[model samples]
Target: MHDPSLIKVGSCYYGFSTGFEGGPGNGSITIRKTCDTTITTGWTYVGTIWNSVPAWITTRLGSTPPNIWAPDINYFNGQYYLYYGASIWGTNTATMGLATATNIEGPWTDQGEVTNVNYPIDPNVVWGPNNIPYITWGSWTGNGINMHVLDAATGKLSTTDNNLWHIGNGLENSTITSNNGYYYLLGSRGNCCSGVNSTYYTVVGRSTSITGPYLDENGVDLNSGGGTTILTGAGPEVAGGGADIFDDGSVKRLAYHYYDANNAGSETLNVRTLFFGNSARTGAADWINVSAPIYTPITGGTVTVSSSIENFGWLKSTVNDGQESSVSGAMGWSSSNSLTTNHTEWVQLDMGTNKSFSQVKLFPRTDGANKGYGFPIDFTIQLSTDGTNWTTVTTKTATPLPSGAQVYNFSATTARYVKINGTNLRTNPNDQNAYRMQFAEIETSGMNSGNLAVLKPVTASSSYEGSDWFTHRVNDGQKNAVYGSKGWSSNSSLTTNHTESIAIDTGAVQSISKVDLYPRNDSATQLGYGFPIDFTIKVSSDNVNWTTVVTRSAYALPGNSVQSFSFTSQSARYVKITGTNLRSNPNDNNAYRMQLAEIEIY
Candidate 1:
């Protein structure tokens, strides 16, 4: 949305922005709501305020423009008034329109034109000194900024003492807020709508009188094209403008849209705390700082260790449960390698679905008894979409001191699985110097899309048909479970390889991008023992005429992990995994069968 406006109602916040090409306001005003208590993320679109372009606007312009201009919303005199424009870009022949409703969620009725004089465009309402509310608007096209007394009763221009008074200039959008004893005029200067090449930035000027001359920090009049630069951004986010302030009964929040070069120059909404401490709050200082963005805590997922010493409170889940410090007792993941013989160990985190991440951190056991006793002697950090095809992100040839957390940073990538493979283990001095792999916590993060198939309809050619290894377990989003909830397994009767197949229906035809298969993780000795050795992945629109997208032979075991298979996009309603050569579990007395703990479809 261009020139977005923000407002808070109770615990809720709403954003109204200009429509896109095929959206409601090239047809009407688009509305969206906040996701959580947090300012923004996964915003819920609340439909357009109106269906078609207002008849008065189309009649004034003679034809509908491909898109609409900036808009503002306010609550005044026990009603909500929405101000919009009937104008095209780079033209002086424009008018600002008004719509008012009893409530925010409204059947807003158009109250005709608010200003058709002197190239009026971006319109906003700012209440000033006495009990008067003033409407302000301006663009670089004509006089910078203009304010007129707004009659709260009719939500229009006042009949007495109202004039098109000039204030500040530069570009569209005049967001005025009265702080202490001064009125501040905020505007965006320079060209916009050019994406990365756009040079637009925000500027500010202040004035003691509500309608008189506004001056920048350098004492230059805004009417003379002078304003102090406040927010000059850089790429990834190149241009920032169309700013508004929202007070939530506490601090004031500044909201705007910045063009992101990394995402094909798409404009994205941004909000930050406008910190004006005591001095800045009193106008003694002119500069204000916008706090850095805050990130949400980890969207945790089920964790699986190749072989953990769960007998001692060293469950795999402890590794990511925020208990790395000395506050807790002996906790975190520790391998079951009690013998002196060295063996490679691994731990993996299944984020439930595909995610985009960059950094992975591992915290060593902080207990005084074993500060860094089992820190990996040599290790590699690997990532995968499906647990099968692994890409080594970084390698530690030599072990580092177990003084604190080990940090690994790399270029951002999207995946579903993260694995820390300890190739060589450090010897525990307290346990007869036995080689081991230990860590208090491991944190790897990123955002998520989600799985399309979790508990969807599934069928299998042969299932264990027991309470434990039922066929539905493959799509239950579980990686760690006891034998009772352990995953799908072929029946004893069909013990031969290539005798097992499972199919999932996604409820509707979707563009299939990837599929993941997870190995059973409950049994330490049987982990990764029954994974399918050879398999074929097939997609079908009708579940009859199937197309094979991938075929694998000599696929390595997951070591009790997931294997992700990403291929060319395929339109399908059903996905099938057919095992050609099943794994024989030596731990299960050479049981020839197929088994998988979970499946993820993306």
Candidate 2:
């Protein structure tokens, strides 16, 4: 069995799986139904939806008993649509067909081939924000991961040509879901069907629009080969793929199959909680896997370095002295001062005060085209408070670095000065003759400090017309001063005086230090429209017990800018911002509302 797709209707859940048996009805799509909402047990085989390969499919693909694979079932407009792929394995001559049923256990009607683009497989459908139904399907040889708007009634392509969205080299099984104004594309990469040797894992990318140039957290476009790994087989699980995401009211869960390492790598159903967190580099949210119900923020605050306390400021073997300024890329570090050498080198940073740190991040030189060129192949980290006495913390050997920052987590240790010594420095991976020891930045994370509210579920008292403007937008990581399309706005034309508030649930209690609010500035005529005049920020552990962190009454906010309010760190799981007195739009007398581009909590 392969490529299982899941759907829930009423009290029962239905799953469609891929199979190929060699007869008239043998290769048809298989189905299983269960009443267990938890989806851990009680699955009853209900048999295949199609009795045999449809005549139309066989004629189009020039094959009989076409191997039907990767079936997806979705209910829309009071009808169940089953989309399946019909093709020969490892070939580009394939077609995706649709079947409709009035019930889950159906006497179905075949809708014939939707498209015959490059061995189209893995048919998945999702409704966009505009309520238009879009279908995504493709395989390795064809236009990888093609998408097209569908004629809702006919389940056929709305356009003449299939639109190629992402080129997943040998990767397929594409699925999509939307949350917090972003559409995430999840796909399986690597060999699948090889049992214990299967290299299949799940990769994900996201875009603000349904049809998009989806990008990973590193800002690499999916079309240009970029996706963040979300789940891979580990320990007892050898491989994981064929993923499907479902929102079960309270929280979202990912349902997929993993090859069990202990059980001869048999594919078995596994489920896990999924989350999205803020990405500082892209100013957008990215998916994260969580073990517990509570989420851990991926990005966090780093320890402040007061100054460098190095034994040798420059590389002794180099002709020009390598400056200590290269050790820190904080404001004034010049590119010319980047420490460079081919021999052993060491740099230490004084953090000004003794602090407990759990993680250290090293950023290699990314200037010009020398990305990940001078990173160390062997390195060790040490900690010292008095600068004279040092304790070796961790050592890494012969690790080839990628073109991005690498992070290492360690047992919590206290130190005012941190030192890193490098030997066996890497020459350029592309150019073996080029050899130098250089780095852009070294950062450390202090204990109990990070963005607390990233990707948490948010709710608001009200929305302006309840259209695109929503409360969740405030925390969606889109902070554009001129593009009002991505922020939250309170109701328009408010005749009665009332307060509007938006609240976020952090999933677990966390210490928060500050909140930054960006007021709306999307319109030229209404540059400061909907800026809150008087507001109060509050935190709460239990929703019933609230503690006011900051309160401003009759205060005017600056337009097109971020206003930050800080207070002593407080612990809470929920944070709320309430506008008691909203500023009236200068252009509209009746419109007294509050709009915010983003809300950052740390």
Candidate 3:
């Protein structure tokens, strides 16, 4: 939720998009200043750069099971260019293709192929220190990744084809990043898209020089088995796989995909935040997911807010300044070299001095040009302490045109810095709510009364695997798994018939709440059971003898479904599920994957 008075910023919104079905991999395009942490504004979706069948990407490649994989973006020759792959499903034949637009949202022109590697998958382009163009990409057909120099302007492969390194028998989805004199190459191994049965995870390797040998933590050759695993799957429904390496100025984060037992990679997106340690290269870093990104409101000082816009792929969308109709002239927004005609541009206010102001206002020079869409403006606002660190306050919206100055307020209590972001412009004539640009003056003042709080879990527990697996069910979806996906299928539970129960480490306890129970469900055609299955739910403060929370007998469970039940308990540390009986479905390995989603202790 965005506070109208405050500008909300941060790439966390990518999670919202990630969770969306058919969401692309470029994640979020950001025009961030170095120090902005709460990341209040200035980000947008350029286009679905990675997904092969992204609705809009249909012009070149026809929609089929396996088409486009991942897309990598970089700016060159005064234009924003997108390089993507067109690989044949379950086969190599991967070709790197190019598209360029004067703006992020584009009327992109397919520039042709960049690589002809047998399995030329996962293509990444970089401009070296001397301004020479270089390309790096990996293959799924073999253990090696190949690198070569390219025409700085044309992207044609140079004469040299140096084997950067090789790792594992086959590596999928490889990423390359450069920082502080070191080049980092990251990749994920094992099967991806297995739904609940996926064995996907991530690993990383780095090199000091742009060329040659990259090594993992123990100094193993990534060309062979040299990279170290940075992340592994945990809890129920194996997680991990498909990792992208990105830096938001302040920290480097590995944004990847995972299937929570509840949605199984259906509705929500999950990411692992990686922090760079003293070593500086990209390897040897601890990663974890703590809910989502954090935002701290600005308080007592006035500071200028500015940004460097990079089209995060989703371009050629609707972007309007303020004009009521498409006939009305609206100024096109652009990066120093944006490709789309009505491309989205980033704007910032030089607050002059560092003073905390509650509200900031932008006066439009005209009713301006409005995209045909009803409410044309879709942008975010952010605040910064020093011109560097910024935090997003909230997202703001506006009609085609406002009389004088349009006021988009935010509730964020940020101090001493302010910046507004303009993004998500719809360019194609058929698109809607496109954004344009116009500016007058910005006003700032006072703070609001709310202090920030943490998002606490409403339910809690841990599961352990044991002989003769157990199945526990949580049926009441309301109080047990608060603020979750719709339909009963959104609940998380753990069902195992183990003599030993799973142990959940509470770290620390807050207050109290209820527990829910439900039978686990899987989509494998191999398992057959109807609606309603019998199961028992148990709770334990310590992983010892447990007390039954709830139980049912000979109940039929909905096919591939989730249900919940609730109970009162103190700040307990562990929870268990034991399978007393099985429905008509045959007992198969992992017939019951744990459904535990969240634990709440108030």
Candidate 4:
């Protein structure tokens, strides 16, 4: 299945996908359904839109194309619309066609050949400023993504304004969605159909207006081949692309396909919850994975780096996310700061339970200026069951200055904790000439991956009801921005007294060593920890008797730093932080409040 789109009916989810194989569905659209609430599983094929290529398309092109690819599904006023593309391979252009039905399981009326353009392959329907239906199609050409204002009544090209609006370039399967005050154009780059060697990945660019120049996280224009990548190949999945955006009310999701390395390199479907990272002035923040994160999941997992530059959505967990940009990726774990680590910085992943893995792969940021810019000068990978004890699995003492994924293969080892300790750091002239340790992603193979704290019970002393500040988000695996993310924060009323607390019951407490705390990465509250001045971290075995692990006062402002509180190992089911003297809210003119982007206890 390639280029899949979804819509939920009363109680069922219907998936419309591009099908080019098998008997009845070749060269037309395929239909599938999953009754399960989780949209990823239990999908059974229904049928195709037609037994063969629609007669209108074959006659219009005067020949049969190989297949109908990239079918985008949409439900329009009093009807359902299916927009797709058909092309003979190697031609610069393909014909984009539309079909409509009252019910999704269609005897779809072929609305033939909508946009007249140089090359139109993937047609996606996005409503514009006035809720006006606009056809965003074309790609597989140098012309980039072009837009056609659709006639609202017919759901086809508008007669009045058929002028093509050239949007961003260097992407395909072009999809656009809006949030806050910005519009994002997400598309696919690289090849997709190849089996194991497929290099397909997703990239994104955003604009303030619906149509115009779009830029990536680092403000690179998309027309010049610039867009931030949100997901890529890792673990059992490879060659991820054919992207679409699904807005499920409170959250936006990225639905794409990847070649399954564990499943004979088959093209498979995957949907992960998309998250907004640190807010930029253009409202174009990098995307972070909240649920169904990109890499091999470690059950009850948490990642803490030795030190990091916490701005621009670069967090420790970003390494584990596995979403690296196709071009010069910017948002990754970078330790280019004044933190005192004795010139050694480390990134550690705590698998909730002991797991087995044979290989670890670390990727350096594609900073474009320097090939091995953020690649560690020298590093050693270690594993440990008890967090305190460690055994070196592999070490690269040599510089190994390469710009791609550095795979370190070792014998299968079992451990709850794994880390890459960078002994010597690379010089990052981009970052004030600081000694830097950076990685775009960290991946482990042959290990059981799952989120243990997802949907776990959470309790907070005070929480803002709306504005994306629900308390349960601390351990939900999604890292969102302070403004856009549903991170936990106190209501504005609690500005003076600092009695706020947040605790996560990690089901059962195992060997706990450290806690990772992320302050909201909103551009407004750029540095300060929203108002967590003085706090005591305590653990409880039965939720009644508590043991205070560490108590600190006069904690200085983190200034976009991920605060890691390491303490003596505690055996407890619950971990809580109670603030005594909460920090002052910078935006509120130094009024005190308690806020946190996320909390991970391990």
Candidate 5:
């Protein structure tokens, strides 16, 4: 929910049914504050009628459905459409249903059953190209898991209901997302919300199509029970499987719930924040609870340091040299006295030649005095290659603050990024004050060893609204776009008719290596085309002269998918994407809306 008057007006949410009876009394769908942890004292219930009565429940039916499992909510048509599952425990006779309401607090109307399969449960709905509706669900029976197209006008299944993929043996609760051409599925592998004994966790699979043959990170089939465990139970809090996967524009995350044995039936929410886990944010299988949500402080100017602390109730030792938001990329560090509170002051670190850093140091800030080791405080310093899956480094109490200038010798830590975390607050133990974090000069590490940085256009191709396709340059191989300081003058007239090309001023680049293209189908007046878009990749050292690098026929299918072409080339000044053709039009048209990802010149 958004508005021009408010940054974010409100949001709607749904969760597992509470199994209450009489009316929708036992079931629940909630909408509350996005950043607020406190649940509203009162809730607007949507009633407890199941989408379909299981054979077992029908046999024992007193009047209503037995239990409601997964509840998914999506906004459409000025109202909220909720897709959920209903079934009797231990029976595969599960069914899916839809309900609509004008507001989160509503008089929800049941739209009838969309599926009558014996194993159709845990339904998740998504909109594909042209606003076409689609639903993905996991089951314990039949094909195991599948995806189906839903009618846009009526929330009913279309003829496109194919068993898209399958998950073998002991798996349920699957979700999917299409980004940069890859459709990722995050599925639960064990039991979830089962008090103290559910052994549930999460696994992930990816494919280029809505329906698959989905494969794990290792390229194993998900239908054959193959997947890379994205998350699992590591502590007493995580017991079973309950997963909800989503992307927040920049990064993808898996949100799930687990039961804590120590707390007795206390199910807590956990999120696995990621950025292409294997390629960048690796080893993210470690489960982190949502009990204490922490967000890093951001600033417009320079600061010595900015940090956030996640409370786990007990003290933890630092594992790695900490990471800070200011240490890396465009939002880099700088110092300013525009602080309104003494408890928290803005600190900045110089990005230097690059827009970010590799690491830094943090200490206690007692009236701007460094308390590196004066206090016996437990600290947790973490680092992320992509600022998501943070890995702890070390947890040692410093000897003390050096007598001279509140500085400590952390040696040459070789960190392009750094973060400082602390405990032992005088006011509230649960909440750590951002101001107490003492800091000093950061040892900015050298640049990355990768190829020269590539610039990716932020705006989409279809929305080529003048400012689209602009180049935001970077000194290192970092992915961020800063304004004014370091950017190339973007070419706005790059959009072509069948054979379009954009030439970069190679005076800035030392060499050229790779190119990535993003294409969004534009079916404005008609139904648009389907997969298999043929095109050629050409390069030129000079705008007038060009050479074909790689020529191959390709396709841009019906759903969300991205295709890329890479080849080695001489230091070229111009890069062009000459499309000979695209998917055949379903409604009849030659119009193509293509999106570009990045072009790398090393």
Candidate 6:
């Protein structure tokens, strides 16, 4: 089997493959279905789409036997078009044909040949930015990969052919996808079908326009023999090729086949996460292959830490800005800053609101040739919601340290402010007896104090109260019960197995500093009532791509006070609070419910 084309219709995913009848060697097109949206499990064979080659294909092949090589499936205007290749092994007489079906499980209507060119093995149709349908196909022996506009209503080429791209090494099985603002061309390189000896791998090139001049990350033009490698055989997987990409709601996923060495180099379907990020070297957006399937939702664009350091107030001892030995850089308290001092000094980052965190990282000064200069020899990390009372997070005593950043990880804790107290100083290596304490940067990771949900529009998976206890009540800014009730409550009474959620949309993407949740405190009996025992705070920019900012299991809320959670800043337009295991309200003995008085977002 080779060249699997995947498409999603309704609630199920369908895959079409080129294969033979007996033990997968017949020249027929087979289809399979899976209810799993990710297509990772529970695949059910849906039988063959075509077993015998059509008379037109047989006439075109002439002396060669009728056999399908590559089959690609795409959906357009409520019709599924299965484009397939008809040719013999290692021949240039290949022709592409189309078959249409209204439903995935189909009685396909043969649409005959669509392309007039020879060796049009891999036929993939993609909708361009202008919503125009374009089909691309070619083989190594042909004129590289060729593209032409398609009339989707008639299932035929509507424009003159254009040479889209090519690589010096023989490559074929082309598939194109438009993402962000660029069109990506994925193709197979090297030889295939040799089992463990197969050198087949995947390479990609991109262009702003779908017609011509595709380039790789290094600015090497695909038309001039340039491509960036994406996937290759490794370890048990002998060869990876025949790649295709599709949007799986949140992120793009690549579906291909790999020869498994351990399984006698049998070709098996493989799917993995595909990430697109800016290439630091090329300054262009490039595709990334993550080895495993990622369940996390990705916001459409890059999210860096907000540059507004002043938003989170700062405090420090010996705050001098002019001298290079000032605490200004250290007190700036951003990931990028270098602070130096010849005396013991302390710096604190005030988050402005209560938040939770679990880790702190300290970077020693390394701005110039001086590495590890003025590094702290001993220090104490403390957390506090109120400045007066502090809880010692960790203490270091005469610890030998290395240059660069060092991270201290601990159990999740809550704080409104974090302080790094320099109890002892290390002598500057270049200048002995010159006691100093300096750091390049300091960062706190995990949840911290800030309400990121304040004033945002609220939504829920299911609402218990249509009017009074609606989802919007959580963000209504009323902490105390105004008229006997304080917030939103779920309708699932005593239903401990149900999962409920409330979400907020901040309109545009904003840097999320922290989230604060206030439990229902209106009535004396409702104190500490209906708080989620297991909960997750998720953030998303497009509502569909959600990333879990924090997940707490078997958590208990004390009283009706506000609970703060902090995370390394994430940019999100939507924030959701999901609860699975809810606490039983004392007033309602039969039902486990979720209730929140207020939610704040910062």
Cα error, candidate 6, residue 199 (Å): 0.7
Candidate 3 vs candidate 4: which has greater TM-score?
4
Top TM-score model: 4
Better of 1 and 2 by TM-score: 1
Across 519-547, the per-residue lDDT of candidate 1 in tens digits comes to 88776787786678889999998989999
Give a tens-digit lDDT track for model 3, residues 355-384. 334455555433224323222266777777
User: Which portions of model 6 show Cα errors greater than 4 Å?
Assistant: 21-26, 64-66, 159-169, 280-291, 294-602
Best by lDDT: 1
Candidate 6 residue-wise lDDT, 490-563, digit = tens: 77765556788888876556568678888877668778777899999999989998899899998976575789
For model 3, the superposed segments whose C-alpha errors exceed 4 Å read 1-66, 159-169, 235-238, 267-274, 278-602
Worst 10-residue stretch by lDDT in candidate 4? 279-288
Q: What TM value does model 1 have?
A: 0.51
What is the RMSD, in Å, between candidate 5 and the native fold over all Cα? 18.0
- What is the alpha-carbon lDDT of model 5 when measured against the actual structure? 0.44
Worst 10 residues of 5 by lDDT: 1-10
Error of 3 at 505 (Å): 31
The residue ranges of model 5 lying beyond 4 angstroms of the native Cα positions read 1-24, 28-63, 141-143, 160-169, 247-252, 277-602
Cand. 3 TM to true fold:
0.41
TM-score of 6: 0.50
Q: Alpha carbon lDDT of residue 177, candidate 5? A: 68
User: Candidate 4: deviation at residue 511, Å?
Assistant: 25
Give Cα distance to truth, residue 167, candidate 6, Å: 8.8
Cα deviation in Å at residue 567, candidate 1? 49
Q: Which regions of candidate 4 are displaced past 4 Å?
A: 279-598
Tens digit of per-residue lDDT, candidate 2, span 313-402: 222222112221233222111111223445665666666645555566676666545567667789888888778899887799978866
